[model samples]
Target: MSVEIVTARWIVTGAQDETTPVIHDDAALASRDGIVLAVGPAAEIKAAYPEATVTDYPHHLIMPGLVNSHHHIGLTPLQLGAPDYALELWFAARLSMRKLDPYLDTLYSAFEMISSGITTVQHIQGWATGDLDEVLGAARGVLGAYEAVGMRASYCYAVREQNRFVYEADEDFCARLPAEAGRVMAAHLARQKMSFADFMTLYDELKAGNRNPRARIQLAPANLHWMTDDGLLAIKEKSDAEGVPMHMHLLETAYQKEYARRRTGTTAVKHLEKLGLLGPQLTLGHGVWMTEEDIEICAGTGTCICHNCSSNFRLRSGVLPLMELQRRGMVVGMGIDEAGINDDRDMLQEMRMALTVHRGPGMDHSAVPTPTQVLRMASEHGALTTAFGAEIGRLDPGRRFDAVVLDYSSATWPYQDPDIAPLDALIHRAKTKDVHAVLVDGEVIYRDGQFTRINRESILAQIAEALAKPRDTSEQETHWLRAQVFGEVERFYDGYVPADTPRIPFQQGSSRV
Candidate 1:
């Protein structure tokens, strides 16, 4: 077999625990046929395989390409004229956002990811309002972008059998409106209506027709309130039938916590546990408002959590008990939900946020997240949540050779202290601009500010051209209807979280200073 040697100043063979060893001092990784074969000192690797071709990054540090474990939408809601409101209120505001071409939209986010050391994304595709065939075509477009770009994607069509707009049933919420508005809202909901069976069909067709070697079909429950128990059961059946994993969004806000207590008279985790849904096969996304009991249940079931740190902050969703989850031996991954704090999908920035956000307001150092823990979240733990499984997260033998090289000059050239561990320095200082090259399957897909397969400029220009056009009739209609319903949606939630409900994350929904 043909062999390749990738050399760098340092090579961190992705961490799994606080004490996982890291390679240093001119380390090199050798691979054959896209699978890692060996990693060692540069000279030893080269001498052992003198005939192998070398791709050396003398000024860089190499590590596993990160996984963006939870994501949705290419365009940010802020860019679509929606303000950052609470999670529930943000739903109505999102209706005013403009529709986008699925192919170009997917490419936009894919570019952002590959350029910033992220090679895999859990793209939970949803919010389609059309016939089955039309939505299927959009799903194809999303997959097509990832395949063309050579980025690994664990894709799922989010299943929402109810509660498309609010926590209440779609019919119930629409029926409560004034007559004229009610008619309009019902018609709007009609276009999005699809049976649980139809969603399964969508999954079957997508899985059968998928041509992306770097992509796999998965399932998502959308959210606890969005799916009926029957709908969730159907998803479980489909998952078991297909042998695929499920990523679900649950307990993202204090309001959602209240909604769950109202529906099942128990915490969301206990309800799911009773339904036999919690397991290693499932990942809970957001999970910001999970209680200590919920965390314990997840730990017991070996269920995974994808913590969207920035989303929780931006939407005023309460923070998940991350410190507690770690202590419970739970597997947690980091995600850039919607967008990062600076309004982009940068996993490096995401890692920093996850590292620092959970540090309590005290002088204690033992419980705070270590650099090793954050790296695990972005790499190995993130892989657990995706269909890729143990295939592509680490730079280890028997795994695919996917890695990113970052120029160490930016973070360490100016006389930084030597005693700090390699990961600690990287976690605190690295930025997107420091990413020098990204390799997937031992093939360099990105290097020196350019993608190997896709043209960033051309794709972006096409997107700009599309959005520049004046609003179409359908688009204009959606904006108008959203304006009329915005106030009603706000009123519907007035005193929604009863005074008796226990608030673990925040005592109140939101209050201005």
Candidate 2:
């Protein structure tokens, strides 16, 4: 086992308690065979590992790499020309875009992730079609790209056996549309349909086929409204029996909360509890509309919540009650989801946003998410949602050496002051360009300005070339038809659930200014 020692001015070892990320100065971390062996003062680590090769970063901040807790295909919906619609309408707009090659698509996002110091990502792969062979191939390509980029990815093909678009049956949804638009949607649904049994079979095959340590697979039921009772139970049974972790989207929007009320007569959290799906093994994404009662269930069940602040704001999903949820001892993770305030997958900026957006109007500072808390959500807490668990989120001994090195001079050294904490500076001012190096499994996968494992420039060029093609005529036709039926979808929701109901997360389905 080769031993390597990395010495930096500051080392931020994200919380062991899983809530607060703490910083150490003049630190050195030593690793052997890709696992961290020790972390302490530079002199001590050097003295202890005299035979190890040493790499010094005199003015850098070494920290655990950011973990993106929830992602889908790595492309923002906006790239498809879909403006920030509610989650429901966003789904409709997505049909208008053209699909890219899986390998290139996956690589496109991996580059963005690496550039911004994200070492791990949970890719919730949602499908518009369920052809087993095609899905399996795409899954392999996605995993292959991550392997090539040397990023750890927890993957799950998102499963939703019902309610493809709105919270209604296909026949009912189509009936609400004009005849021509109805035919278009029905045809689309027919192409996308798959038996519940087939989904499980595909998952099993995917699990068996792709065995890369960095590419772990898990179960994800798309959402409460999109799943049937039997589908939920089957997923729960498989997850429990196999001891694999599971994640699902829950109450991402007010409409989803209302849909839960209309379907189950209770909160989505409570509904999951009754179905034996609420447990530490399951992580719920979004969860913006969760009520106090739902928070209790999440806390009691030890379930984790992934807070996608950027996606929520863009999609008009309400702000997550971060303070209340954390106070209840619920595990919270930070995710960029699809896009951030800058409409890009930049973790540093996302961290800043997560810290800022929760500062409610109050004299009590405790209501705000501190830099330490936000850092933990981006690091340690985020790892809980992935298959790596506690192995890769910290720089402590016995953990994988997954870390990012920041150019402290760029963010803090211009006016260096001992009074300001390095952690505070990083969470507040660090930018993606300030990321100097990224390491995975004790190896410097990205350094100085290039990736060691793959030809990033060539891959990106190929992606650009592919995207330059004009949209297919058939796809354009589909886009037009889908747009025509979008109003019908809104009408269906308005007719079934009055717009004035208290269950909506905001007033009139719009964000509170």
Candidate 3:
């Protein structure tokens, strides 16, 4: 039977035309076979579909489900303590920690994301183990968690050869590595520097197993920094051959810029462009240290950038010239890099941080990103970044019926002027607690503070136990090594400064990314 949901005073579809026109008194939506059939006046739609199952959501605002352009569900349990050092040091500290149980971690993160109204996530896998069976086992566990929670995701087994150098340490450190870690890392290395054959095999396996054709899942080469010239090229070739998109961390920090210049005799973006790897299929993450030439290449190639505002600020990564990128016709999407950095996968908080931060002082305060723009970055543009733009993002007839319903009566007071615009309220004032319902492909996965399809309590308990099981960190030379790896990263910032730059870090006092 068809499902009919009605009684939304306003609907924000995330369409190109900003404003989502209000329906008379009550609006309604109808869906069948997990695809939207119609959205209009309740009376009209109700009369048209007499036999449809009806759900009333009086006075609520309905909108498209959020699309998180970049997320790492497998990293949620690692949201341990704050990293008060530089990028390299923080990465080292993260590497030292014991890996969490993949099933528990994935389920915990998915539940949190769903509760906050994220219907889709482009998940970049970051864990490492030695054997192929173990690595695939961990990945399969994550995929199972996503399926169990009824969430849509684009899963990418992140690959890199450059950063592996950092992980390759003395025998003592290697000996301390978790049992599962060795197995997973080995499996990944065997397939390292992904070839066309590897890509086809993985693609075939995924395509054949996914019974729900509407579920958007793709294999991606998740490269970070200047991994390898050959590996980068191979990633591009494989993605083109399989007709899937690829993603990577590009120019995330000034350190990467320096590293790229030293290694390839060019800027990071320039290096990728030189390799002929810049295109619409490529989704570059961070892009905080981009140059004007880099911006031009992105616009010309129609490549999208995942703007990770929270992680950038947390690690002292430079601010991304967002307005400049937008002005040049570059597509931008929002991301919470790892759960450990953001502390939570709340998109509303992520959106708020993006709008307020990144605007340097003395720049017109009014020039900051507006609420609507932030919402777009997390929803429509985010979907576009992952090459799933046509499948998800907006709420419209013929599109997948993915949506989130917020309770306006919450303590956060989502109700404002009727003329204030629903999208504005959603972005500027909404909180995670305000999210009362979430749907992916017309399936009600979360509602009334509980998950409809999964056992939230059991997953939470499993993750807590997994995190509590202490691994041997005795190999760690110092406690500060767990906290701040380089002693003092701020010292490096003393003498050197950017041209005409403000003294303050980008995220100084801003709550919004």
Q: Please tell me which predicted candidate would have the highest TM-score against the true structure.
A: 1
Which regions of candidate 3 are displaced past 4 Å? 1-3, 18-25, 74-78, 81-84, 165-204, 212-215, 224-226, 340-342, 358-366, 411-415, 472-513
TM-score per candidate, in order? 0.97, 0.95, 0.84
Shift in Å, residue 360, candidate 2? 1.0
Cα-lDDT of candidate 1: 0.87
Q: Name the better of 2 and 3 by TM-score.
A: 2
lDDT (10s digit) by residue, model 2, range 1-513: 878999999888776443355667799999998898988899999999899999999999999988999988755667867777777877777777677877888887888888889999998887645487777787888888898889999988888778887888988888888898888888888777778887888788888987677888889998998789998999999998878899899999888988999899988999999998998899999998888788888999899999999989888888988888878877788888877778788889999988888776657766677888888888888998888889977778899899999998987656868686777877788888789999988778888769999998898788778878987776777789767887776766665656577653321324469
Write the residue-wise lDDT of candidate 1 on 1-513 in tens digits: 799999998898977466454656788899998899999999999999899999888978899989999988887889877889998889889877877888888889888988889999999999888889988998998999899899999999898888888889888898878887788888888898887778988999999998777899999989889889988888888788888999999988878888898999998989999988899999999887787778889999999999999999999987777888888888898899898898899999989998888877656676788888888899889998999999988888899998989888876768668797666788788888888999888989999899999899999898888889988888787788888888899999999988786544522335568
| Ranking 1 against 2 by TM-score, winner | 1
Provide the RMSD of all predictions against the true structure, rounded to 1 decimal: 2.3, 2.5, 5.5
lDDT (C-alpha, whole model) for all candidates = 0.87, 0.84, 0.69
- Model 1: ten consecutive residues of lowest lDDT: 502-511
lDDT of 3 by residue, 358-394 (tens): 5555566445666766777888788887746667777
Q: Give residue 44's error in model 3 in angstroms.
A: 2.6
